[model samples]
Target: MSGWLPVAPCTPRDCAGHRGARRGPLPAAVLLVAGSALTLLGVLCVPAVQLLGAAHRDRLIRRWAYTVVRAFGVRVLVTGERAEHSAGELVVANHISWLDIPLVAAVLPGRMLGKREIRGWPVLGPLASLGGTLFIERERLRALPDAVHAVAQALRSGSRVVVFPEGTTRCGRGPGGRFGPAVFQAAIDAGATVRPVRVSYRSTRRGPVGVDGAPTGPCGGPSADHSGHTGAVAFVGDDPLAASLWRVVTAAGLTAEIRLLPLIPADREPGRRALARAAQNAVASDSAKRPAVSVHQ
Candidate 1:
């Protein structure tokens, strides 16, 4: 394995497939069956996530996430090592698809800070709250101070909090606006370690699962990108959540790439702004030699 790099830039064309024309929804029969199965799984797992203790909760969360990703037919490609988080450590990552939540959770398994809107998202809302997500009303400026304080306290108490500093979803093709410096104060206040991460998605092709429940293809693997790669899972703009869900379920070879950079010691920075700049630069710089792909031997 290689050491983490400060910069990793992605090409704009990498996100082209996501913005392409909508292909409509999947077959109603397939959608109905899949939706029912997923809802049943969610209902069964939410209680375990809530009633269990920390270690058990995190393990269950990881298993739930892994099952859901595979159910959606999404493949993950990770770059860099899984962070060994210290108490009060802050994880900052770029936001792309709603899929980013489970993908990141699958690897990091921490409490997340999400916009208030997610709290009302049907079955997901209740599960998220039970799973320890902290909800914030980002639009209410007056509430910002208190929220930051609460986050800081959580950090100080030895909780791992994941925050998407961009404040809104953006294409993974490139970095969005500067990382909002407001939340960095939490890291500074708690003297927490700050870690930056980058996530990107791409598409490829493979044959459908067969009666034997085995993936079959010419080489029994993803086809070359040049042959066929469809962005069946990009969520941006006003794209409806339902549309993105349909895309992910029906498409083959959808992959999410997550790159975790080196961690920054909070005390080394003079203030939150300086720390924020360093963290942003660490995630924004596309200087990593090449992203390492996870492949089964």
Candidate 2:
């Protein structure tokens, strides 16, 4: 790995814990089948979806992304306002699981900024390529400028670009990795508005407690204990993709919450470093006021 590439301290052994409640083998198998089928369906539709108008295509993509997450038995709860459908906005969120990709796209369907290695993954690689993902070479610091330029060009062409500036996945229970400043330059260069989103996971189960020993509630309600469920979805260092997928399907009452924060005008920020810091701080702040949850299509 390159020195510039951001790495989280979390490992599968330490960060990913066994949940107290899990679905039976049969139910988990069914969920796995359904999630796989939905993903393949999205892949097949990509070609046709590309021919549609931008607004129509985005609507279809948003619907497909929402379904994919739900197919894995994960409830999607979105709070705060999404950025306007108009382009030239950069959507930045905390990195937790592979599910974060679809979770973010479910609300703000846009061109994704992903690591270059993901372009070679099994089913998702082709789907991401067809969906217009911008891949960056995280291992090569020399390629950073070119990657930023590509993202800036996309933004300038009136496209909403979504990026996880943390560079790698982190367990969601604690204060996770900081946002890397490089990608923020693309937003500044293109004069795009930065929309910071906070992504967190909570469980509806009663028995499993959080890392801090907070009590959990029953199904369909809020729980102070989120660590157990959050671990079920976390994709951290040295964790196999298959293991993560299995955990997600087997976990019960898992909910992914997306909190969209206020937008920061890139032009107003002193530079990319300040822009990155502002967005990170906005996402890190926990709101005391409860916001109305938006239904995911």
Candidate 3:
């Protein structure tokens, strides 16, 4: 085991362990204490954190969040070069995992909308608030105006903004893998071009099959994952945070691949289901079409 691991198991178990070391620790005590402290402090500094302009604050918060995610060991693999979009353009992509934030932030390097709970997280929360991320509490519904404003303000300020219209992770299965039409309103409201991106993780591209990961293709998989329970980084808006974090902490490093495509004009914005279908295709298309893994896998 020792000798093989040193060689890099190229297997999920080893990959998971590497991820644990990167994310920090696996025990609840560590996360609990750290998370609790941060939560408390974020509340205390709420007023001060809100002082910066949304873009300025979220820039800082995103940096902090990306760092923390990196420290946990989730490496982002981006492909199909990211094109510059006008300030009001909305960057849309599939929601694959919770770690999507750091994974995307590492390269996309922009402001995004997060769940309300993320806004309430301790040091990280305030840091995010300051970084210009708009944290929305869906249950409250009334907060939609504020959330929209934050996104609008960011774009209006000439900063790029992003949204995950899937509204949740596919968990790699079934109907909802497609993006919901309701979520599309944000980009329309902002009058932004729709730049679609694709994302996926594979067990191996150069390695063997023993460590099978989710298989994706130009049109999503002909393959299937019947074990359809949510993955560690549940992208679904409703998964419990504690459980989600636990899964992410315990999982191995993901070979994330992102393909950023051209900006579609409002006149060209694909209808409800088509938008997600386009992205889904893009994610796999980029990977399958690659002559080589151009970006780090």
Candidate 4:
């Protein structure tokens, strides 16, 4: 049992199929179903997340969300140093696998901002909404104003709003994966602090990479990398609620790392791309240092 734990970095074969292979070897399909069911249950409970009560309840929702999928046998390893966060911050992260949902949720103690499609998901979406998730539809310029307003309101109202400003996920070592400027404008308008987060997946079950960096299926977002021992990976925009959930269950084996960078706040009345660049640099640098699949994708 102790051997399953990671001591430090080694070759691809070292950690392959050891931890996941253990546990009496359940079928991948079985684990997938189990994980999916737990997630569905969490979704069904979304309403309770909102109705329940205080910040503590919200934290419970996020933690439980992470736990439900974790039952599938995916290990999450959080690395890099976390930056100090001030009140009313807007956290931005490089979107990757669906495992990212919990990775970021684990670190943030505030409301999450997701795409509108999420609100329509079977059970998970509702749970997310009830859990104080802010939903915005893509390419809706008209709605951008409202979305910004909601984010501002959330921040001023004493609730932090975490936004994945790349707008969607993508595959790249770069911090830019197709960013949306409207949200940045919103932050400037609201005078909120922006923090960047980078999410990555390294295998513990398969060899090096889990899958290719190229997206798979109708990936609602970024597809996790798959390198049977090759160390390949895939990053995409955002996945439909279902596919994201499946990534965890079907993963041959892997560890997810979510690194939080220093928060960049809106001080002056107007902030520029420079500020955004600053935040991006912080996130990219720290994220690059963390281990996983290829840094190339």
TM-score of each predicted structure versus truth: 0.78, 0.90, 0.60, 0.71
* Candidates arranged by lDDT, highest first: 2, 1, 4, 3
The true-versus-predicted C-alpha distance at residue 21 of model 3, in Å, is: 14
**Sorted by TM-score, highest first, which candidate order results?**
2, 1, 4, 3
Cα RMSD (angstroms) for every candidate in the order listed: 8.8, 4.5, 10.4, 10.0
- Tens digits of per-residue lDDT, candidate 1, 33-136, equal 56547645775677656777877877777766655665666677677756676898889987767788877777777889887888888877876787678888
Encode model 2's per-residue lDDT on 175-235: one tens digit a residue. Answer: 6677888889999999989999998876666554333221232222122243434567878
Candidates 1 and 4: which is better by TM-score? 1
For candidate 1, which ten residues in a row score worst on lDDT? 1-10
lDDT of each: 0.66, 0.81, 0.51, 0.56
Candidate 4 lDDT: 0.56
Model 3 / residue 139 / CA error / Å: 2.7
Worst 10 contiguous positions by lDDT, candidate 3:
3-12
What lDDT is reached at residue 53 by model 1? 88
lDDT score for residue 58 of model 2: 84
Pick the winner on TM-score between candidates 1 and 2.
2
Off by over 4 Å in 2: 1-3, 206-229, 288-290
* Most lDDT-accurate candidate: 2
RMSD (Cα, Å) of model 4: 10.0
